[model samples]
Target chain A: MESQQATQVVLASRPATARASLENFRVETTPLPVPGAGQVLLRVDTLSLDPYMRGRMNDARSYAKPAGIGEPMPGESVATVLESHSAEFVPGDVVLAQTGWRSHVAMDAAGLKKLDVDGIEASAYLGVLGMPGFTAWSGLEVIGKPKAGETLVVGAATGPVGSLVGQLAKLAGLRAVGIAGGPKKCAYLIDVLGFDAAIDHRSPNFAQELEAACPNGIDVYFENIGGAVWNAVLPLLNQYARVPVCGLMVQQSGTLQHDTSADYLAATMRAVLTRSLQIRGYINYEFTEQYFDSFLREVGTFLREGKIKHLEDVTVGLENAPQALLNMIDGRNFGKVLVQVRSNASASRS
Target chain B: MESQQATQVVLASRPATARASLENFRVETTPLPVPGAGQVLLRVDTLSLDPYMRGRMNDARSYAKPAGIGEPMPGESVATVLESHSAEFVPGDVVLAQTGWRSHVAMDAAGLKKLDVDGIEASAYLGVLGMPGFTAWSGLEVIGKPKAGETLVVGAATGPVGSLVGQLAKLAGLRAVGIAGGPKKCAYLIDVLGFDAAIDHRSPNFAQELEAACPNGIDVYFENIGGAVWNAVLPLLNQYARVPVCGLMVQQSGTLQHDTSADYLAATMRAVLTRSLQIRGYINYEFTEQYFDSFLREVGTFLREGKIKHLEDVTVGLENAPQALLNMIDGRNFGKVLVQVRSNASASRS
Candidate 1:
């Protein structure tokens, strides 16, 4: 924190295809922004890197608006309130804001969410206690509707959302089977997160392994990466299986080769009709007003008791935020990807 | 009525492909068996030809088991009880039975459901007042969950299930849009069925016309024919759209060429996630124990008051049952396809 200037990463150009590259982002520095009346000057601490950012790079219709060229890539981050012109927050207070990839931002106090920082790190809100955590909770309870005896299969098992989904399903008395890219995440899902079983999606016999892990057939599928993994889950889905489609990481991530065979739709429709499947897609905010309070109460208790465990994959600087996001999209980054702009944990604890 | 023999249409062979042909069924004759203890002799009067029966012909696992080769093709029909061996029923009673394509068969009294036939035709138990009617009701109310001022689109809009779906949507205060083949059925959908708009699926500009029809975007799509029609409905669907996949007529019918371009699934999955869509598949029977009585009460009243109307495409005699089913699957039938095995409207009206 020696410079009087603020650093930010902006969208340099839109990706020509679903796959995004480092060339699409640019880093620049400007004079530190001053807080206006009823606003606070925030110094970014931890920036959340999500796969959804890839969708924002394209000029496609999504729940949120696409990031414009020369505009800071949209994101949520934990920041320290350096200077406040409002009664709600004080200097050195940690708050959450949609300040994108900026090292510092002048934001209205009305939009900032203050953190409790009660034993847990302030950055925990951006991962486990924030949007990713909320997404997993809402999608599982509202759409997936897993029953105690049922089996639930979630993709991206080591990522923030899928990890929470598996742990929650296990807590709800379901047989949780997770699908991850490697043996390490797979082992972590079972050994660390208490998942009943975990299958490496990259295995040559992935489908057979998934089926073997879920001997009772999948009752709920928490869909994040939709591609070969979705196809594998389709046939094994039990009658009236519920699929809560929260993300399509494989679709947005340009690394996976597009399978040209389209009869996949026919097979999907067949399974849907024959097995009476329920596939519902949703975003977290849709359930905020309806279930957020309950979510906070329940997940907060679970977090405090150590019933749920989470992981964070942090990059070191604001300039490298773009690479962190790209890495997350390509599944090269593990856990909840984040960019640590400033590492002063004392600011929140004090 | 003088014959002492029973006639049956058995599955001669399973279709090698999705398209079933007349050769797959064979008509056979056997000596009529006397009613056994606790069984009654049922004379088939009206056999309901449903799209689901086409699924039973192939050796594919569906809601019902695959029809055994050389065994009678499974179906439900309105029948007349000729002899009773139990106190539960007597002769001259109208009943519903799963006797398939048969002129006469002995059924257990426990399985035979005695029909009132108070004002409506006993055949109505096979169409507007029966499974077709119930299918539309349960799918729309339970799964579709349409709200007032919302747009509801249905394929096969002039048939029994689709007609009732559109009428029910109209009655529920929705903008009902129908997708049918040719100008005749399209006109009938708007003029007689009271659909807010009707688009001819046969038109070269079908997608454009459909988009124009649903300016508000589709909220409930009663998916019966899932092919190009489904493709057309995908983009037009609004956020939180509900699709109750009752039948995939196009896939089973095999009249429409399989679109070799397979990007349809990607488009479907993308829309499902971006728009937060809900696509569910179900059979009417799943809701039978829960909502059947309510369905009969509401739809029965609508039928009597003329608030709802239905059409019966009848092919006389038991031998033509094969063609009746084929006609339905191929979209040649104009309305509710039924095989009138006996000309005895007087049996119920008396």
Candidate 2:
């Protein structure tokens, strides 16, 4: 299984503006390096593509260092160890690594997380049981603070974080409302994930649809797709509503809307003052040290019990990873977007 | 002394837009009413001219009902009991009441808070130890959550709420930065109030100066001014910063700034996610039931010990209340704006 050449997608150029295109990325082939002392040679199984990668691609002052040009685009993936020099792991063992958009890599054993692929699929660790799932849990429980009978609204409802958020809010006895791009995702939110109401953000009357759905007003709003959805969320937010701003997937296309009218800014500021709204932004790792184990225990159990459901939109090969990411950012993907590097046999999940 | 007639400022008309004017309020003379059973007739001493009055002047959807036309403008004041029909109060007793901008009023005994005016001046109850003080305490302690050595920035630094917030943050061992309107107020913040840094919002180099002052970045931003000040603040906010949204005084003047450029709102939203910033908006009353007693005890002690300082910009008549409020909203008044209805005899405060 150890091929001489390893394939990876590298950032060929930075975007001229917020929007990135296929030309900005290049599929490069490099000779796979052999494992050194305390290192492992791993073949990528599945790679997780998320919105934050957009921020990293640009040279700006951000939470983390920008993804460099001519380097493999930053990402995390589930992989299979082909050869190991560390005592903790052996060949055939699946693990998690920050391998970026790569098909094969040599990584120090210190950075790898051994995956327990007992009853769970390997790719599940790339999303539902990994960073996206942890993000949903931490933001909702720690920031959104979903309470029984409270109404919680999340954007990108079919995506990993939003889907898990809506489901968890429902399990906590909240009125879970979802905002998605199309009729199918909206249907999936209500029928598959048990969302109380689902509104299409792409609809002409999206704002009105959202308002009509949340008659009592929104208590907790999980902000992921910024701009129009945020404008709609502002007025409908209840007094003391908590907004856990997780990601801004739509912002990359310059779709971030703001103060279109004088009243929008005034009303938002006034509401923040009068209604006591709480708008917080965060990354997942902040709560990892404190809440990760509890999250794993709780959400892991829900997944095993079939109480929480997740969807995956897979693209085969490392070359298609860039297009899949662009589609995900454009709200064209139906669910969590993943690049399956190897074969369909490893993609099976209950 | 009981009067045969009373002078009160009433809402003549709601503002056509966000900006309220002198014409919107009218000073009217009417016959004084006798105290009914379980009620007291009170003579207003100091009328608190708060920024919230600007909000009540509008007919828009808000936290409370709009000030009714031809009715006394809503407010809280320190008044002397002139006539009483209840066993709880008698003539000469000073108390706190929701008396509006009136020289005299007939209020139910149940609605009055009997003042324990001893070493503390009665006018201090209208500013430092009253609602403004409570607003400062609750927003800073409950929401801002200031940690020692962290930097705290506040707009309207010379006003009642902001002044107290800065002082409290200082006492808690945090570095305090104040944003005020002019050189005079800026000097007062650093010289009199002990603010580590003071930047005049009116300065040509205001934003640059503010960024330079908070070299470590702002951990807590007490949002009250909401406009150019907010624009200057967004980028300077540190990761995990807590913003207590108490008021938007400058917003009434239509000074509320928004995404003037595409990157403004994008940068703000992105920072909220990456830095894990918390922007919470609230009115003082929400925490009344839970934290009021603590506020009064803590702030009362601070005021008595000379640990907290406050300033007042006073107008001599109830007729002047409208202009004073307008001035406060426009950032023209230097300190906590108050309408001195009667005389300077009751104006003495430590």
Instruction: Please report, in order, the local distance difference test score of every candidate based on alpha carbons.
Output: 0.87, 0.86
Task: Give one digit per residue, the lDDT tens place, for model 2 in B85-120.
Answer: 999998889998999988888889998999888767
Give the winner by TM-score: 1
Query: What TM-score would chain A of each candidate receive against the reference chain A?
Result: 0.89, 0.89
Best by lDDT: 1
Candidate 2, superposed: residue stretches over 4 Å from native? A1-45, A50-74, A79-94, A99-109, A116-118, A255-267, A315-333, A340-350, B1-45, B51-74, B79-94, B100-107, B255-264, B314-333, B339-350
TM-score (C-alpha) between model 1 and the true structure: 0.85
lDDT digits (tens) for residues B185-222 of candidate 1: 99999888899999998888988999999999999999
Q: What is the TM-score of chain A in candidate 1?
A: 0.89
Model 2 score (lDDT): 0.86
> Best candidate, DockQ-wise?
1
Least lDDT summed over 10 consecutive residues: which range in candidate 2 chain A?
A256-265
Q: Which ten residues in a row have the lowest lDDT in candidate 2 chain B?
A: B255-264
Q: What share of the true interface contacts does each candidate keep?
A: 0.67, 0.74
Each prediction's TM-score against the native? 0.85, 0.82
